[model samples]
Target chain A: MVDQVHKEFRRRDLLYSGALWLLSLIIPDPQLHYRREYRFRKRDLFYLLTILLLPLIWSDPHFHHIMVLGGIHGILALGLTLFLGYAGQISLGQAAFFGIGAYTTAVLTTRYGLPSFLAFWASALTAFLFAYLIGRPILKLKGYFLALATLGFGEIFLVMVRESPRLTGGVIGIFDIPFFSFAGFIFDTYLKQYYLIWGVLMGLVLFSKNLIRSKMGRAFLAVAASEDGASAVGIDVSRIKLGVFVIGAAFAGLAGSLFASVMSTANPETFSLNLSVLIVMMVILGGMGNLYGPIAGAIFLTYLIDELSRYQEYSLPIYGVILILLLIFFPDGIGTRLRIRLIYLISYWGRKRRREKVEL
Target chain B: MFLSVEEIVKHYDGVMALNRISLQVRKGTVKGLMGPNGAGKSTLFHLISGMERPDSGKIFFKKRDITGLQTYEISRLGVGRTFQTLQIFGNMTVVENVLTGMHSRIRGGFLSSGLYLPQIKKSEEIAIKEAKEILELLGLFGRWKWFASQLSYGEQRRLEIARGLAAKPDLLLLDEPAAGLTYPEAKQLAQTLSRLKEAGLTLFLIEHHMGMVMEIADEVAVLNNGELLAEGPPDMVKKDPGVIEAYAPRR
Candidate 1:
């Protein structure tokens, strides 16, 4: 009897999903309705409120430090999503851009005695220049060839940083990097640093949200969908690719500059092929092509890594298995899957309530 | 002539795809290209649109030499084209696909766009308004927000043309726009094409449906084995011996 009841329930669930799918097809959900009417979404408001209240609720310095790291990773992933996700290009050397930024900040602030504020912008400029120089040639490649080419670039950056001790401190890394300060106020406390990183992140998020809906964003989507079609529509495919690459590099650079100051170090080990792969993994896991997906992925992975530390050496294997499972189930990304599930749940309840009313 | 191709030649490996093909498109007229398989109709379109540079030839649009220009450069010169295969951005909504075609017409810097400056917002509003109009013209206004991939095959073809038209091109190149359309859809497409011609838009298309081509095309050019066989009014081309022989099925 119990088995039969379970089967009936399963059948009802399948029927509900099928009806929902069909309904979705007939009257397509106009996702922009809210954006057109209301400037802010409920989810956006929720995230803002949570971010605003997090400091008061989470007073632990260790948690604050980890969250700061998550914010940095969020920046890196956000930049990379523009290149790897939006432009539909493969990049395995984004960490090189990150390294370039960190080193630029490190060298300028330590050697030239530049202020952190000036060094931050300089780091972005240096990374942009580096991306532009290499992007012209590298961006021409597609698929695995592009991935390999970027990986090679990252390896070259690693070797150069390690070999140049006088400039980059030779793996021991640059130290005593001054904290980020603005107009005589120093971000000396953990709370200050947390706000500092999150503030930058929020600004970038807002900027990216606006960009993804703009004309250039449309061009990026066109290129990503079909290069031939994009060119046919008067969008310079190569130029767009190069532009996204440079922009992604600039973002990485900004994050790296903040990272150098926050962590008070610039080391070759921090920006490695492993870290590059980790960033890519974060993008894949968090979801590609959405603004918040990569950020969520970064935080999730950061927390996961921290929690898995108790597993000692076995943590790596466990983490790999979990990633494989995540990809299998939510290949589109956790954010998209969750969004779809939420819609389905709401529609299912609506249908059930309507059926109950009809029966009455 | 609004557009002219002079002795265009294109080769792939050891095979010649287009052999010294030259054609002219008069302003505000519908010109149809009819050809057998491997007759290089699509190849000629690609060359004209700058998808690939012809091995040798000169193409002029509005009397400007556009032979060596890039595809986007050619497009910016008021040339819009739809591919033989559907090139719709499947993930994007139908309206967004059309809006993307209006890329060159709207001007806003990266910073301005990212910050959603007032000028950028105005441009975006205009873009949406224009896109909706184009979609309505294509009979896709109701489905503007639908994903391009989810549209029916006929709608997808119409969406491609809608996207091409959204660019406000002086010369539009359509490759096999009615290949998968139902009879009614093809008729609708023909009507749309006629309306576009009446609106003073020049159309150059490649098609296999002779009935639709003969009915809609002001002039038709027939190609056989990568060579232009005949060019004349659709009625005269229909009676041409070479054109019939090229299209006739082999037993």
Candidate 2:
């Protein structure tokens, strides 16, 4: 009886996979032909539609809060993508820069009573300087060694935040941080913070798009492709690496500043290894080497974690299982895989309609 | 002399890669360096291009000692090269690959580039025009939009040369430009090299195609066991006993 049941199960599994294969082969993926064209169009539409409809669709404060968090994570992922995806450098300690940004804003606003506008720029500058100082040494290492060194930096930042009671408010962290304000307009509510973060994300995205399409961006691609070729073509490889690293850190810093202001708090726990890994995950899950991959990844993961919170104690384990299964199927990214599948389905339906018309 | 190498020696873990190699080439001449497997043609190229520093030697380009300068510095001083392995950017379009080679000439800092300033746009327009011209010059104009990886082996080899030429280099170091080309493709590459020579660009090449090398090389240097065995015109170098013995060893 056991042998009979196992045989039946195997037969069913084979049939299911065979059917999937046939369906895939019959349909066609348009992404292979128009990948770049679709990305450019879809990205513009996504930003436009969100800006127009987000306020009406997500009026609730809780939804707004989630959107705000998603926007901040989006910024962080964008920066990480430039370093990891574009420049082909792996940084596992991105949260360290985020932490520095948050801490800078928190300390500056709470202790020194600096204005929000000034504090925001100061936070980014501080993170940029930090990245520049350490990048020269750390950027020398490649691949996994670079990843580990960055992770170490993140851990060091976490420890510093925890230990420096008088400076960073210790484990309890800084509280009552002021809201981000421009001139006289204050972003005090979740609704305002949502628009603020998303607005900044849009600007940064445009800047990133321009940067990626420029001569310097080509140099980055060349460097990533081959160091010897890049140098042969007159690119200062080390300088480009360092520049991208600092720029990524600066983005993370800006995101951190916004995050601290929105939450009105800065805590060591918020910028831990878990957050660093999550940001990296967002970049990978969205897609590497593409501009909006990180944004798509950030929103998906932010919503996923939020939705999975209903599982209570089992939330993380279930999430882990889903992530692993998804990764196994779509190693390139969820966006690319979904785009291909969607295109295939549409083409399949179109072909079926044409065949029916011909028979008639 | 446009470029000269003097007693350059290199060793890797006590294995001598280049043993006191010396050579010179006049301006606008095609110099060919040929040797058997592991005869240090690549090592010599690396030393001259500043990819690797020589243990004890000096290199002069345009009469300036450039033995230990960084690769980018040497490249900026007009030393361009192509890899033995095709290093074309696989994802980027053909024109984009050549535009990458224009990195030294294009002038724009991060802010100007990020903002897409007027001057930067002008420079970019000029670069695109120049890159397209390069593609046209190499007979790859129709495939300008295709990705580098999509091109055939011969086209990719030509694309690599196009990228090197885009740097506007006074001298180009080509490492095995005809490595995987068909006979016709190799002949076409030789024609292109001859045209480049006529246009006043000095060429330093390491090729295994004896026919192609002998037909086009203004000067040929033969390396045997990491040492220069013969240096003369192609016919004279081919007739040298040491050069003949280096290719076919006695059992």
Q: Where does model 1 exceed 4 Å of error?
A: A1-39, A342-360, B249-251
Measured against the native two-chain assembly using Cα atoms, what DockQ does each of the candidate structures obtain, in the order listed? 0.65, 0.61
Over B79-155, each residue of candidate 1 has an lDDT whose tens digit, in order, gives: 99998899998868888899989999987867888888889889889989999999999999999878788899899
* Real contacts retained, model 1: 0.85
Q: Could you tell me which residue pairs clash in candidate 2?
A: none
Q: Give DockQ: model 2.
A: 0.61
Task: List the per-model TM-score of the A chain.
Answer: 0.87, 0.88
User: In order, what lDDT does every prediction score?
Assistant: 0.87, 0.87
lDDT of 2 by residue, A27-122 (tens): 223233211222144447656676657866869888888888999999999999888887888999999999999999999999999998898999
Backbone clash count for every predicted candidate, in the order shown: 0, 0
RMSD of 2: 7.4
